[model samples]
Target: MAQNPAGASAAGKPRTLAGRCGSANWVCVAQCIDVTCVDKCLAEGCEQALDALAQCAEKSGCGPDDSACVSRVCGKQCGRTFEPAPPSPEKETTDPCADASVGAGKVPEEVVGRWTLEAASIRPEERPRLAGQEEGVDVKPRPDFESALVVTSGGCFLLRTKLEDATLGRGNTLEIRSWGAFQVDEKKDTVQVWTKSGQAVGPVCGKPRVIGLSKGKFQRPVYTYDVEGDTLTLTAQTPSRQTFQFRRQTQEQKEQAE
Candidate 1:
């Protein structure tokens, strides 16, 4: 997990942003600012805007709704407001693998193996194609993504994914490695990974879209798996309900490739 610059500066305690507004600078003095907002501002080097917000907060005497107050004040100086992001609609814990239908036996046992990604694709409906990308043309995900997953007998899993998208920006790539304990319902043919707080590792693209994924378990998407001989397929639904697919790699294939 990446430590916040503000928090890291104070020997683990959050340090206030620079400002001189006395008590009204409550937002700056906050033990922790909204990470998403702060990160965005820092990325853009918006110190002046931050200082303006601090000054506004100090003068305005923000009420109980600190977020709203910050938004209202910061908007004036920054030309944009800072509202808490809307909660993911996918927060409902609906298990898609609830039905005990296809798998021959326990899902955990069936999924205990390594899988290599062959291809990946993102639906256009979920994210609009970048400029100059022809509509209706199938863009192969292999060039943009390299990923693999390993599931262990002891109900643990490790996944690594690296993606490159030139359209995002010059030389920007997203890399993520996540590990956590997993839960499987044998009867339901379902699996969900309960990630620990700081499991995500490695550098990721600086694009705002990928930045959120740096934490890795945002909303903790659910997944269901199917195995057919040497072929294993796992399907996952994103927070926006977009499905992603992954295929398994045999031990022989993995070793030979290595």
Candidate 2:
């Protein structure tokens, strides 16, 4: 398992994105209940959205009404009568993996440290064809022989895969997961990397998609990392053509404690 980012600078704790619940975000009715006495969401500019949801749910007999409300909230000051704004509403969203039945396991304590992406090996891919060529089109994930990103925890990573060119950019999802269960040996100066998913998977042209995998209990015994010169280097097997190096996160590099 890998560690989740913590401290002040860690990215916002991964949470469920709104539209991820279903194929859409504008839910006509709560999957379970509708509390608003009046039809059509009466959220006057998102300010009263949460309150309305809570009140409506309570009125409609939804148990723990407060927990049922979910809306995209803003952090702006909208005081018309010179009063503090109401707290934001909460919603019940399933983790993306939960739908696919994926769980965030406890990353090992040693793996809890940070690792810089010294190398990102993605294969060359074709741009989205306009038309006509759609049939024989061979679109694949662009190879990233080099790039930047940091690994938190030692398990699987779900990341935003964007390839940039000045202001213009191309994008897709990229998966880079460790091969097997992460085992730590602070005394041996070695970090064993194995494959649970057998091999790294895809560059599927979609955002928020799982790419590289280690599905079960880390299968492939792929790379081996050696802590050298304040950095970690990972080597892949033949035909894999990928090498990754990382540096243990230092105290200063740690996000300021929140």
Candidate 3:
């Protein structure tokens, strides 16, 4: 994060943007100022706007360090009186995975960390075609993307992917995120992931959509896995065979890479 420029108040004392917005709201405020007119509003002492942005960030479940979510969701309303449209009253549905358990399996010590996707291989016949491509074309090219996987010792995991679209700007890139519980069987060299929830968010030719995973139901996918030094390989067992290679990432490296 870049340091905010120091500004002077009428009392002739130097004040920073972080100081202007209380520490609790600083993260969202900083992100708002970066992509909107929140900085100017702050200089003019717009407390209401700042408070609204902070509230929006919290209600939307954005993490403290999630600048992208802040900018995307709260930026437009930063300098104005934010009036969120009331959500239509609908029946609340319970999430099946809210209390789903991984059940009776331990996460391997070597797999309990962050990993970055390094390479992937798929048979030519099973390769996925690019959007809008003609049929029967063997020109299956790998999509430009970055992905990260986080496996926890507590049997939980998160996978995040950002698919790059050359025609879209950085602010509107496509992102897929999923979180679930995983069970590893050392004896069988297999890992099973039960996806609790997943979502896709971004623009497709200027049309934005947020689609749920598999109609909001749970999915269990199993893979044969191998770990050698820092490298981890996962090969699909059924359907079409595909393999993915990942490299373990240190805390510092993960921070810098992000």
Who wins the TM-score comparison? 3
Write one digit per residue (lDDT tens) for candidate 1, span 198-253. 22122112112211222222223355656776565445544322233445676686
The segments of candidate 1 whose C-alpha lies over 4 angstroms from its true place after superposition are: 1-107, 127-139, 163-175, 197-217, 237-241, 256-258
The true-structure Cα RMSD of candidate 1 reads 16.4
**lDDT per residue (tens digit) for residues 157-230 in model 2:** 32212222110112212222222234444555444433233222222212132322222222223344555666
Model 3, runs deviating above 4 Å: 1-105, 124-143, 165-171, 201-214, 256-258
Model 1 whole-model lDDT (C-alpha atoms): 0.39
Q: List the residue pairs that clash in candidate 3.
A: none
Instruction: Pull out the clashing pairs in model 1.
Output: 24-58
Measured on C-alpha atoms, candidate 2 has an lDDT of 0.28
lDDT of each: 0.39, 0.28, 0.49
Per-residue lDDT tens digits for candidate 3, residues 1-258, read 111212212212222343332221222122111111123323443354446555766676667666576556765543232111222133222232344363224688998888877765533343353445554332222354566677777777766655453212222344555667778888998888765555554543233545444333333557888889999887767554456678899879788755
TM per prediction: 0.42, 0.29, 0.49
* Candidate 3 or 2, higher TM-score: 3
